[model samples]
Target: MTGFDTFLVADWSAAQGVRRAGKDAIWIALAQDGAVKPARHFSTRLDAEAWIAETIRAEIAAGRRVMAAFDFPFGYPTGVVEIICGAADPLALWDWLAARITDDARGRNNRFAVAEEINALFPGEGPFWGKHNRDAYPGIPYGGRSRTAEVSEKRACDISAKASSSVWQLAFPPTVGGQALMGMPMLSRLRRIQGCAVWPFEAWQEAQAVLTEIWPGLIEPAVRASDDLRDRAQVEGLARALSRLPLAELERMMDIDAPEEGWILGAGHGERLTDLARPNSLRPPPLRNDCFALPAGVDWTPVDTALALLRERLHPVTGTTKSGLFEAEGRILAEDVIARRANPPHPNTAVDGYGFAAASVGEGDAVLPLVQGRAAAGAPFEGPVPRGSALRVLTGADLPAGVDTVVLDEDCSVGDGRVAFRGGVKPGANTRKAGEDAGEGDRVLSAGRKLTAPDLALAAAVGHGTLPIREKLRVAVLSTGDELTEPGDVPGAGGIFDANRPMLLSTLARWGHVPVDLGRIPDDRSAVAAAFDRAGRDADVLLTSGGASAGDEDHVSALLREAGAMQEWRIALKPGRPLALGLWNDIPVFGLPGNPVAAFVCTLIFARPALTVLAGGNWAEPQGFEIPAAFEKRKKPGRREYLRARMRDGCAEVFPSEGSGRVSSLSWGEGLVEIEDGERHIRPGDPVRFIPYGSFGL
Candidate 1:
């Protein structure tokens, strides 16, 4: 006899006595030699439980191990109300009430609580014969008086008791009646088996899918009725347990001998579990100190000329190498990529149909005999179908030899091993000829092009494993202020919180430069000088947000002169007019205005493109689109102005307040509309060019 392990699920419905079918259905699944068969269903709980117990006992008697899961709650919450009231046992009080309730005992004086007590002792037998009114059952203190209430309480107790007694490894709450009571015991058992309770069904399904992908063969084959519940709970428990277990023990459980190999075991699933990972910043180049103050009344270079100069100076530096596929997103290619081989290496079937020699088919009544062989994926036809012959092929199958045309299966008739095509078939009909996508050794991607997913796929198809990529530039960020405290800390009366660090980090990421935060530097010139020295030693570019202006306390400009050489200072711009550009040990340094909005604007206009140049990419300035102004605004004539403005209905609307010191204006504005050197008072409906936030390294 072949012994099999089987699980049975039984469903039951309330006994309404009108030939009612059970709402609950039980499933009996077979597990033979560690493999589970498709489950069979049963409509009755009694039948399911009986079969399960019988099978378990028989398996044990035959010296075979068997595990079963029962759908029920096992433990009862003994009624403290009755116990504390000094009533004998609650069950005794229950029985005394059961004897008094009769089917005809309804009316004003009917004692219903007594009936409820009786039903609690014997679930599934309900509709007590007692009355509806009473505070407590007669002669029983605190006993439920309503028949309905008593019966409900009794069923809860019964379900709980049944769940506690089931010795199965796992318990599933019943699908229907008494679910509330059954749920508690099942949850309790789950907590004991695995520290955490089961998640909701939807989340459980997702967790199970993830586990199956990562731990291919670890889980048993049987899809337990509660497999989703068990798998999710167990996986979470395993994660917690594994964290506590020694690395060696965890590796043993994962069936790995070394830690490196074990780490890779769950790599696929781990990637899906977390968000995208970013690479660490590369060390910056050294700087040279040769501070030279800006010449007074000097004519500043145009944006285009300045960018061209910066590009020439910075483009020679190279970036770090990364995997071609992983580096595809947000990375520009260093050189043009030519195809080493043509796409679709050979002529293949474009449709799942017949492949016939085009020359063999005549204009009228020409029938070609079908070859016995069929072509499918991975199986190409060995030889050409000779003249007057056809071969059957599926989609993606290689075209048969000497066949230049394919007649879709719908356009052909087959009989007696011969296929006849409909009229009007052309020589190259349905044929995807060679080199249709690209010729052999053709240039696929051009130099300086940003690599997208499609580009990565194309590169892989060409048999290239690694690609030459320009490295990411390192930009050092320093926030300077003696009156600033870190976020989440209590600040003194004169102190403000640090916001520039996070803001600069996000901005640098957008601009494709890796930002190395040097935290907050103090107001002292020595401390500032030390910061510049450190930045010069490691950073390709240094960005500071304060102490750029000429003031007694402002030290960044003075420190830059002391630490290295000054390049350009004091751009003729509003809000960020005090901006300073220099070099510290040969690394470029940008000292932006201390105001939050001004600092942000300065990074967008200057620092961002400078980093792009250092990263070996083009330094194209953000383009502006012309739009009408919603309101009139006044500006100085000689200086270039950037007003915080937003676009709506193709019109640029300046944010209400335009003060350089007002940080709140930044929050209200989307970007700035540059009013070049000649413009002064602009009226509503006037055409103005505005640059969007996204285009300006935001």
Candidate 2:
């Protein structure tokens, strides 16, 4: 996966004045390898543009991928592109603006004059609006849309992002019209460099430098909590957030193909971007253990005793590997995964309501003056609300400092900039506290547990990009008997295509192990011995089908016994009565029955859990539920039985045949019905334990 080694985010301004510092100033922040440097302030766009070009050049010289982001709209709405540059291409508009727009070193520009010139091309009023000195540009409307507007108020990306203001609204904190006028030329200038490419308009994956539009409001909670000015904090926070994301996520963010009306990065992933606002929390080392040697025994074992032995003897045999979250699904954790940051990252509102200090409200109905600005998702209120005043807050918006209580919008009556509400609401009601779900350093996932899709989401919410996973266990599988032939090959008379090797190999992969094919061997003792030797050298464990019983053609068992390393046990189980457990050249081997049905059942009931332990996980246990039986059976039992069964109409129905040669029964059934070891009679309504195949990690 390719990723950027350096990140830069700039908060642009359109003010025409001398060099200045503080709010509404040009601030550029740089981040690398999860660490953010102090933001550099610039009083003029010319100076900021020069510094950006120099930084990109230096980083590219050092062979680093660089992502340059700006906090402004990259293009206007749908039809505006065709009208401004007389073409549908967005880059053409950049060229158009670059040729007509002008700016200087002391923070001076002719953006208002350009807006006036563009407004003359439209009909009644503007597709452009809002200026500090609106009277000077009479052609541009002070507020409201044009009667004959060529474009919509907001672009598709802006609508999906729930941005507070349209690109045309320029008189407020969040507007970007004037900034776009001044910034487009800067983009056009930057793209002229040899290796710089504009995203969504040019190929960006292999470029040495990429430039894209960003919206810092997507992670306002992190910025609002900072002690620095809003402009500086937003730039630094966004740069750090982008630098920590994995390569796949960054690719997904820029997957949009908007060449005419360019898109904003992180537009639809608001909660995801917000959760990854901070980095460098912590991850403890992986747990290490190796205990996979079974005791030597040659006795008839009961089913319960065999299972107990496996649980007692098995432990992890694999090491750990670092994997990004995108590729970590179905893999077992090698240790506990800790949270990198608090969930929510800051206290936020759970409802669209009014927020104020709870102590200010008395027993009677309370009326409080409303604050000037409202807090919406991705756009938090700037300062703390007064003790006696209430601030309007939307769902998922961060609560301003000094406010701890909220009253739902429906519960309050509003008029004259004052909200009156019943006074019995509890403190912190309708508000979620910071770190309520999972705090920093909290264990989000445990060792030996297989990761699911929801687990990846939880880990990301706690600010993790990579995870520690156990290395996959390698299990070699082989078959014996000249009667079997590989699939996709010509077989001679009386020869059957091999089924057990393919079935077991597929099962091993689904259970998260690497399956190695050792091919098929004839019923010759020397050939079987050679295959076993090769398997021991190449795999952590070996699984062999057929030739376990003491018969004329049972060469696998004969070779193992001659080596003095085999333990042939007669387990009290139906269809899978004989199980050969032994070691060959120090590598464990499981010899399964030749019948397909028996091999599948034994692999699930015994080998699945054993393989899990050997793959750096804990003992695997399948969850079963008792369901009413739909068939009747009479049994005089000294052994446990697993019948191929499927669920229908809330009852367990077993297959008609119990023969080990009925291979199709494994596919006909959804799971197995376990019958206990006892003399018993079962009727149609009797409860039987049914375990689904999925419960065995199939």
- lDDT by candidate, in order shown: 0.54, 0.83
Q: Relative to the unseen true structure, what is the Cα RMSD of model 2?
A: 15.3
Tens digits of per-residue lDDT, candidate 1, 1-698, equal 11113222222221212222222333444444423344444344334434545655565566553323233322222442243224523223323333442222111212334324534554333333322234544422222232332222332323322222211111122222232122222233232222121221112221211110122112112112123433232232222222222222222333422211111223222211111111212523433343224335656544444445555455424444434365456676666677777777778888888887778777776678888898887898888778778889888787877788888999888899888877668887787877688777888877555567888888777656555555556677888889878878999889998878778877887766656667787798888887777665445678898888778767888766564565555466666665667776677788888788888887787776767766666674798888999989877666677899999888999987778777777778898898986657889998888998878857
- lDDT value, residue 583 of candidate 2: 71
lDDT of 2 at 397: 95
Cα-based lDDT at residue 123, candidate 2: 69
Superposed model 1: Cα runs more than 4 Å off: 1-297, 316-318, 322-324, 331-336, 357-367, 407-429, 438-440, 446-450, 620-628, 634-637, 680-687
The digit string of per-residue lDDT tens for model 2 on 208-265 reads 8999999888877556656678888888878877875544457768889887788889
- Summed over model 1, clashes come to 28
Q: Candidate 2 — number of clashing residue pairs?
A: 0
